[model samples]
Target: MSIEAIGAIGAVEAVEPAALGVPAAPVAAPGFADWIAREVGQVDATLATSENDLRRLATGQVQNLHEVMIHMEEAKLSFQLLAQVRNRLLDAYQEVMRMQV
Candidate 1:
């Protein structure tokens, strides 16, 4: 390809707001509390599903024991992870509270 053709091919096409002196759009980032709330909410949903499975098994309406066990394990793991995250956050908060500042 000719130099001019190559130059055209290499030309910038991506949006460049600063190049045209236009301000970029604002983007909202999730706060730490929001992130923690989402994690807890997900774990709560898993636990609720596990509870339903337990209820079904108690009522002799369970389809598969294996599936219930899997759900129980999944719920257990999610709860454990969420609990650990919460504990760590608490510890961090306590540490910050102890700070001189």
Candidate 2:
């Protein structure tokens, strides 16, 4: 249920004091592309762990069925959340394209 990847939502770029003739400082925080890559990597890892647990269950190596089910559910939810975010971003991009400039 934790969506730490969405923590990039409020990141702002560093601005320069152009009026004072000062150059802009480099941003220290990770960018949107990095965040997306990290989030996708997390989702992939979750899914892989769930798949491994399922395989272990099939091989009769898993003792707790509940824990395996929980992992599966976690993976499912993570993927769903990622999908929703992608859909929203796509919708926004399409809307922007349709706007008359």
Candidate 3:
């Protein structure tokens, strides 16, 4: 499954202000920390699910080995993406620290 699919699985509905008889207000975007935390949580959950699938396969509980392998690959890819994001964030922080105010 793709990132969009994962996001769709956890999608939340937006509530309109008019429906609640309230005035619309500016909504603050999520901070980088919050975004990163959420991503990390998703990656963790993916890894855990993949691991469970693997265990099930090992115990002869799972009928399809291909599905287990796919889950493993998905977990691996998500981890790599998270690691790259972390590296980029660290590099940006270091660059900012080196600059003179």
What tens-digit string does per-residue lDDT give for candidate 1 at 1-101? 58898889769688799789998888889998898888888999999999999999999999799999999999999999888988998999999999996
Top-lDDT structure, candidate number: 2
Question: Which stretches in model 3 have alpha-carbon errors above 4 Å?
Answer: 1-24
Give the TM-score of each candidate: 0.72, 0.73, 0.73
- Residue 67 lDDT (model 2): 97
- State candidate 3's TM-score: 0.73
Better candidate by lDDT, 1 or 2? 2
Model 1 alpha-carbon drift over 4 Å, by segment:
1-21
| Model 2 C-alpha lDDT per residue in residues 1-101, reported as the tens digit of each score | 45765666557556559756887786789889999999999999999999999999999999999999999999999999999999999999999999998
What's the lDDT for residue 13 in model 3? 80
TM-score of 2: 0.73
- Write the residue-wise lDDT of candidate 3 on 1-85 in tens digits: 6888888966768878888899778789999889889999999999999999999998999999999999999999999999998
What is the clash count of model 1? 0
